[model samples]
Target: MTDIVMEAKNVYKTYGGSSKKADLKLVEAVKDVSLQIRKGDIKLIFGPSGSGKSTFLRCLAMLDIPDKGEIYLGDECLTKPGVDLNKARARIGFVFQNIYLFRHLTALGNVELALRRVLKLPKEEARERALAALTEVRVTDCANKYPAQMSGGQAQRVGIARAIVRNPDIILLDEPTSALDPELTGEVIDTLRDLAKEGTTMLIVSHEMPFARDVAEEMIFYDEGKIVETGPPSVFFNAPSTDRAKKFMDRIIKRTTRE
Candidate 1:
């Protein structure tokens, strides 16, 4: 088996170029970007707000189809014409920034939905697995609670449970803690830290510098829809090679310290 769990090659995605709006210019959200995540790799991508880190992540999961380039999940090239994206996505877990849990379902129900529906597991087995996932994320106490009843931290942990219930090859998180209150962020970050301890392969777009420094195997500095630099956390913290990365780190670190 290949060491690479996921790979993106020359991926490009654009929007509004052909739109009829006279004032709208084309937006190249992901421009010729390529990345690879090997087994048990924890890579963090960080940059300015509108730099397209989330877009690139979506393209990696096939949630958004790229206009050009190839995305590979292990040996399967997901960009191929006849590939089954649903199956491909099943092996990949995605945690959104906003924590989109189903309002109607209890936390367990939300997590079990995929195992029961998509994976076609039996009822009892799905429930057991769902409970186990909730326990793993430290959200088992919220299993019977609906999204509306849970706190932001609890809801996000449930969201994580839902994603990991399927035992995906890797988890792609888009600023998982950004939507929560500052006080609530710690619980979520702790859960992620636990996952890191267990060697989960994750590609996270997060600005949590402490978490990144502690958990990430490599840090990628992305900007303007392109990767400006990539290196270990120590390299970025001490000295980034590129001027852009250095400047960005200075600004971000100052802001972080202020906060």
Candidate 2:
């Protein structure tokens, strides 16, 4: 058996209980979703916008509370309804589409904040860790720059730096390259691939299909809040089992093979 680092069982989430008109509908963001990510695996959860991909990632990161189901992080239960959610959250590092950083803090400060407050490390130690994280993303030169002063890619590097500085074994990325251009996207993707090589477990919800095929050890196609197909990249891309995957590939070709 693969060394499992994270697992989600029977997970479900609903949003929007009320509507402006009386014909309100509760959107099921995630529906009975279950999957396991092995240690050192780079797994991609591919889905369209509003397909619950982000919500699923947030639930995995413990940034959002799930309505039903159980989540396990290295044998620790995350969703017990009344369990201590903070402890569960501390174990997963999260990076998002938008780089959330303090406007006044430098890139180094952004990465060091969590180390200083959450990890309770001394200032020098935290700064050293932050520097290492920035170096990992090849953005150590931007350490003293503010978020507003840096490029989107540099800001994103800082975001990744902040997430990894905690040294969490599992990193959850939520559409991390959604706003980045191709060049910048490649930079972060390269950094992530290096992390995967170093044995860090990663769960990525992304739209970049080619990157998924190249970097992910395995991938799942999510639609209507369900995983319709899942397998290694070769099987997922070349021998998808379901019609949903076929249709998805068709769209991918239509978009990519366009003149």
Cα lDDT computed for each candidate against the true fold:
0.94, 0.84
- For model 2, what is the error of residue 135's alpha carbon versus the real structure, in angstroms, after optimal superposition? 0.7
TM-score of 2: 0.93
TM-score of each: 0.98, 0.93
Q: What is the lDDT of residue 66 in candidate 1?
A: 97
* Top candidate by TM-score: 1
Q: For candidate 1, write residues 34-89 as lDDT tens digits.
A: 99999999999999999999999999999999999999999999999999999999
Note the residue pairs that clash in candidate 1: none
